[model samples]
Target: MSIREKIVKEYEFLKPEMIKTIGELITFPSVLDEEAVETPFGKNIDLCLDKALEKCKELGFKVFKDSKGYYGYAEIGTGEEMIAVLGHLDVVPAGDIAKWESDPFKMEQRDGKLYGRGTQDDKGPTVIALYAIKSIMNIGLKLNKRVRVIFGTDEENLWRCINRYMELEEKPSMGFTPDSKFPMIYAEKGLLQFNAIGKGESVVLSGGGAYNAVPDKFQYKSKDLKSLEEKLIANGTKYEIDGDTITVFGKSVHAAVGEEGINAIKMLMLALKETGVATPSLDFISDYVGNDPYAEKIFGVLEDEASGKLKFNLGKVEINSEKSLLGIDIRIPVTISKEEIVTKIKNIIKQYGFEYEERDFLRSLYVPLDHTLIKTLRKVYEEETEFDSTPLSSGGATYARSMENCVAFGAVFPDGKKTEHQPNENLAIRDMDRAFIIYAKAIYELAK
Candidate 1:
């Protein structure tokens, strides 16, 4: 049989084992713990990293671990140039355990889907990449370059894992990360996280998780909510009134697509303003931001053709007797400068007595469509799926930005649903089976 045919047959035989292996990795609640300073990211992440490295070793690939417990890699083949396949073992926290159909740490198979936290994000894709490498070996494919699968431990928060990889490890000649959707992501937008700090003295309220996700729930405990119940219902906000506690409910999604989410923080702020219980922060959203996730009132739908519109996410909010602090996440277009975006924000918020404190920024990434890396991956993708499409751009950040000539390849297909950073996160079984074939063929093409 041809190498492609052999890969298909091998993956079919190994699909059952693949499901079992993914379950093992998901059992770890690998959320980042700031208190665990002795280890990188956290202890749970460390254990997860160790478990991934152990699996790589079991696959008979030469493995290496960072002395500082930051990153690990599994390699196969012998050559001067190396191709990196990036995946992260860490996942976002499962927001609201009640939202999940099962334990977010336990993988479940139903209706051709695997329900778990990291299934669609990186862990499942990581396993698919591993099996792809193994399948190529089983088919006796020749490699002109070494292929390395690098496992990162902190992708949900700061990318310290991949950042350290760049500092301490040998750079790959070219690579692809399976953290994004197919066919190919040639350009990604710049990311900015900052807090809009202003004065406030009112009822206390707070909500949200990371700077990169649209918070699903925001709770405010105050007798003022009783007066606001009618306004909240009139405004069409999803919420629950429990005695003195008012909880606003919204759909959680990645900040890159913040427009799709109903920000509970936004809903709560507006409701406060409507109920005559406005703070400086609530009035800010009510007057300036409103319900527009694109922040058209502030920036006039700031966008460019290369990376689309700037995405705005009110990731976190706090209102207390002292001050109002709002944590905001913005995905700026590839052609836009950080200063331009920040200046625009300052111009708007400063009038409301708020100062923008810069938190974290990831520079935008763009690779020309004609580049060989894009061409090779694009050719293989079209061949395998019989679907032809142009290279896509994204607001989402990936490891592709960490290296030269590297772009994010697929774990999610074009038609597949995105469950990353959300509760009951899942990956379709059939899509993963297709990814197995895609990664195997692409790896062989890139390395050979």
Candidate 2:
């Protein structure tokens, strides 16, 4: 039998085990909760890592859980070179259960598709990677390198999970993360996180729950009902008017691919000034929103020519007497500096006499598109899918950036693939089987 056929046979044997594990993992709601002592993100993260470690032990591989709680491996090989298969266990919280045809956490097979939040994003790919390792082990493939599958915790928020992993272990020779679109990732844009704070007391505001996913539902409240209502309508914006609550409506869109949703908070804040509620801080926000004279000035400093995609999200907001707080999220292009962005926000806040603080600073992750790890994985995907798509850039950050010599792989296909981060997040059963086979081949080739 050919190498491909051998890998397929090994994958066929692991199908039942893979299905059960994936289903069990999909049952937990791994949403990031800052309120908990250990961090809600860490709790779900530990759960996924434990599950993975248990399975690896069952498959008779030497497993290691570091002091920081990240999962690691020591698969035997004779060479100094190491091959890594990086995949995250954490997933973005399912936005709304009402929008889903089925449960977001419960894995349901519909017309051959598996539907769940982490199914396509990372969990499904994680399972595929696991079985691929199993296939290589079962066949006793002799290779010159050590292959490790590192499971990370925080890909959605800050990536402390993978950072701790690197601190404990040696960097891999080459690796692939089945987190992005397939057929080789030639380039990924630089990712930068920005936190902007709104000053003083104000009302009529709203924002997003997660920085990555688009904000589906945004609500804003203001004490001055008449001005808020009038400005909303005058701007040709549709809004819901109740006794005292006025919520503006806009199409919610993925923050990275800002095609539809205009930020409701920005709209409401900009409206506050137009409706005669002007403060110095509002002027700063207006400029940042591309409304004032400083839009062009900020872009020159923030834009990256290599990636050529600049995206931003107005993530969160709170209205109070001391001040109205707004969380501004920015995905900086390749050329911007984290320090520069922070400095800009500080200057803007100082100009308005508002207090400025950086909540979370996420540095941009860049892997040259021409790297060998990406090119080899891309070749395998192209040969399998028979499609001619190029490696793509994403505004959101992943664990791939934390690990050296690593690039994102499958999980999300082309735009035509099933809805991800949407109400009915799911994966096809046939596709799950196919992914297992593909990952098996990828692991075998890389491990050998």
For candidate 1, write residues 285-387 as lDDT tens digits. Answer: 8777898988888887688877999889999877677888899999988878889889999988998889999999888887778887888888888888866
- lDDT values for all models: 0.87, 0.67
Give the poorly placed runs of model 1, Cα more than 4 Å off.
Answer: 94-110, 195-303, 310-330, 339-356, 421-424
lDDT of 2 by residue, 37-73 (tens): 6543557767777777887788776788776564545
Model 2 spans > 4 angstroms off: 13-51, 72-74, 89-123, 138-140, 153-160, 184-251, 271-278, 292-294, 301-306, 315-321, 415-427
Error of 1 at 424 (Å): 4.7
TM-score for each predicted model, relative to the true structure: 0.72, 0.76
Residue-level error in angstroms, candidate 2, position 80: 1.8
Top candidate (TM-score): 2
State how far residue 57 of model 2 sits from its true place (Å): 2.9
**Model 1 weakest 10-residue run by lDDT:** 222-231
